[model samples]
Target chain A: MYKQNITKTPKAAALAICAFLALVTAACLLCLWHTGRSSGQLTAEVYLDGELLWRIPLDQVETPYTLEVPGPQGCCNRIEVRPGSIGVVWADCPDKLCVKQGFIDRPVLPIACLPNRLVIRLCPAKDSSASHAAPDAVTY
Target chain B: METKKLTFLALCATLSLALYAAESALPPLAPIPGFKLGLSNIVTLLLLRRYRPRDAALVLAVRILLSALLFGQPLSLLYSLAGGLASFAAMCLSGSILQKKLPLLIGAMGGLAHNGGQLLTALAVTATPGVLAYLPFLLPAGILTGMFTGLCAWLADRYLPRGPSS
Candidate 1:
């Protein structure tokens, strides 16, 4: 019967899907693994609509502090900065996704809010000691 | 089109819209902008198997447009439309590749494309290249959520009634 042929192919289809799912899962894990968890010193930079709003050296800050950054159309986000890390603790944006993102303690992908046009990125602290050296590192 | 087909399309569209609205009410699953369960695709996958491609596409478009009007911000609308179209195309291709037999692959591929589309839109709109870093997180979220939705659709397909041809 025609149905028999159709039935025979399902196993192969299921197997292919399983393989594909495994591949996607593995790729996801690999991506997370590569997020590059850079610990130690970090600099927290907040950008509003591509403009630098605030820069805090996490290494220098002794006390945890919070500030409000204004956005277009009366929107705003509240940022909390600690000695070694920073995060968006509150936002007036309807999605509230930035606040949900919580604190980022390491150098990884920035926490972004498309609606608020806000971004919080943590980068490895620059070496001020190398400021005067026009050395081999500058040419590469 | 026959009344039966039209009715089915309407029902699917309504189901999709319900899913869209329900999902909107939920808190963000992750911090990523475009990451969501994409549960509405369950209806899309089911329609793709039972009807012509055009019919399925019409339902999807209607759902996206109507949902945009009902509960979406302009920026979100833009992102959703971009992601919806990209994911729709991916699902269509994957559906054919899987011979409409495996909804999970279609869903997973659709999810991947959706994240890709949103990323491209985010990059273009903000002119910020750094957002590309989100790819690592979004890809996995899309695949996992897409597979879940696809699995649900596949099960529904087994028990749900097809068109009159059945």
Candidate 2:
């Protein structure tokens, strides 16, 4: 069964697959570079089930504080907010991936708790028109 | 299915489940959430190479269901089902076209598809677009891990005794 359906050029097929994946990797890297580049005032946005639960300007924050964000099925994620960074300090989810993600001071990535449906992201402050010029404008 | 084939597939399912459990026990390779090495995929790829797609699918379904019931939460079941189905589909497609030669390539594709499926599910469940940022990190990780599992499958297929094909 295998002999009859064997591809004519396995090497070529392998090359094609590698090339395609490499292209995808490159594109992803470009996106990473673009997203990681942030400047000026940064704001941490906490979301639950896609709704904006909290929008705290990192620059305006003088004292670090923790906020509890309620999630589905009585679960909650405790978010730790510092002057320049934010992270999930605790969560009731089984995986606790968001908590493990630690803190984020850049807009490069968003800490997400899949089980709790909570997302914490850092981006440019909406009020500052200069620094917000690019990152949010580009969508993947 | 023949009793012999059924028994062999059952064994495969058990092996995959064991692998899944063991892999989950280890510390995560990266800090990223939902990232995994997908070691259980070796069994799925091996099944695809030796038997039929449907046979591999059955084993995969069994492994997913059992793992969820045993070691995972209800919410995780959704992600597992999505990732498992997507991975199996990719493996089947690549295996059929490429035949048994390029297990590494097939596995890589499966890994990417699995992550893609899970990411999509995350988007829907959380309704958060910021989750998309994980894509850049996940893509490369998927390829590397997929290649590793595929290589393992290739070695196992090379050494293991042939099973009755359905």
Candidate 3:
């Protein structure tokens, strides 16, 4: 009888799923805000899909450069670039696993998807300390 | 009675092994380890329907060990054990709380409990508190997968005829 009375329609399930996703999105935004407060300078340019989309001069500021690339609109996989690194910030991929993956600041941290044909990277200035690690990159 | 119990255990083991092998051959889901549907759960559903809790427990222990051996992923036995045991416990507990027709909820609870158990084990193994941040993300995944596996079980129970004894 408990099972008979337990009304679990798909609509209710879908609503619950939507609510969970909203919570996750809010959490991600909260993390970004937390990181943004202690931000560093942007001293580089980012390229995606073989195009020069963003440029940041080291002397300009000490804030992380955040850029959004234009592509298939509404998709999150557009490349994101900060002073010290670059990565794909958003993609319309089904999994959204890339979005779940936050920024990568290491020189060797590369985020890519062969199926989407997307690539992102941070190019350091010629005179900047190559000894230091690259800037941040967020793959969506 | 012993002969019948042994036969059921053997069948469950075979099912678990087949599913484990199939899953092992597939590439990792993303880069994270130990994230999957645990398709061998088909056996769990079957047991929940056809056998008693004690029988279900025996099947779970045997399946986890046999699957771990088959895959050579012995290091993952701790994870599997924690997840499997938690899942079984949850299923048994929820079975009494819910109904025979509500196996999906049982499956979902089992999945959620299993992931929680796995996360606990991961913390112990890796000695990294940062990894626990992944727990919230996995919760919804567990519920979703649990619902799916539970649905499969529900279908099995619904369409299949009751045993002669019943």
Candidate 4:
């Protein structure tokens, strides 16, 4: 008799939750909108704890280069950069999410390793032409 | 404290661990970091409904610890512990405040808090403020996934046998 199944919640509480979920949905959409904006620079900026570690200009790179980023507690992430594209090729972390993210040529949400505190985002460069550079003619 | 109660709690813990393993084995639902279905929470939520808050908390702890030990790395254990504690705290607070009226809402909030805890841990370890950018995506994913897990609990509670015998 002490424990009755609580099959339903009050109408007011249910409405409040619905409203909260709707608000969260809106905020997520807005965040996505912010991340969707393309950067003017074609540089992949790697940040370690908000500090700029390396900025690879995708347009200028003639060959693919992999940079090892040092993280907290002796952790590290291997980020590969190529012409107009960048990605995490390897990382010493549990999730491996940054590595799974694959290549990113567009400016969007950063690929992050939470454990290592590493963030890689393609950001706009000061030289506007770099963002709109011609395709690598050498490959063709 | 009683032998019967302890055994029942242990069984619940085992079930929760199985759910945790099952959920982890599934491919990542999305590419976003830290996104999870949180299927194991089903046991915790159910325990919260069926037993006292203390029982629910103990079951949650056992599941988190056992699953982490069996399948996760040390660093992962730390992250999950942080997230687990945060979510557990959130759930307990919500249960008390709302008088267990809305497990769905509590689950959503707990999910959000879990992500927030992980995000904080990430920020602290990496000392990177940029990680905050992840919140915009993580928070929504948590709410959605939490609701799913919450519904799973609700459904299980509604159908699962009640009382200690069941």
Chain B TM-score for each model?
Answer: 0.93, 0.97, 0.89, 0.94
Instruction: Enumerate residue pairs that collide in model 4.
Output: A41-A124, A41-A125, A49-B128
| Best prediction by lDDT | 2
- Please, what are the lDDT tens digits per residue for candidate 3 over residues B5-99? 57757776777678777877786564334567767786787677777877777778887887766664555677889998888887777675554
lDDT of 2 by residue, A19-86 (tens): 98899889998888876674467898777886778888998989999998888888888888899889
lDDT of 2 at B1: 80
Question: What's the true lDDT of residue B52 in model 4?
Answer: 86
* Candidates arranged by TM-score, highest first: 2, 1, 4, 3
Q: Model 1 chain A — which ten-residue stretch has the worst lDDT?
A: A131-140
- Candidate 1 per-residue C-alpha lDDT over A1-140 given as tens digits, one digit per residue, 9 for 90 to 100: 89986776766766776687678679766766555554567778788887777778899989998999888878888898998888898888998989888988766567898888898877667742222122221000
Report the C-alpha lDDT of model 4 over A5-83, residue by residue, as the tens digit.
3333345556766687778779877876765564544777787886777777788998998889888878889988888
Cα-based TM-score, every candidate: 0.67, 0.69, 0.62, 0.66
User: Against the true structure, whose TM-score is highest?
Assistant: 2
Which residue pairs come into collision in candidate 2?
none
Query: Each candidate's lDDT (Cα)?
Result: 0.78, 0.82, 0.62, 0.77
Interface Cα root-mean-square deviation for all models? 10.4, 6.8, 9.2, 10.0
Candidate 1 residue-wise lDDT, B1-166, digit = tens:
7887678788889999999889888988765556789889888888888777898899998998898888876677788788888988988877876678778778888888888888888778866566676677888788888888889898989998665541
Per prediction, fnat is 0.31, 0.40, 0.00, 0.31
Candidate 4 lDDT score relative to the true structure: 0.77
lDDT of 4 at A2: 35
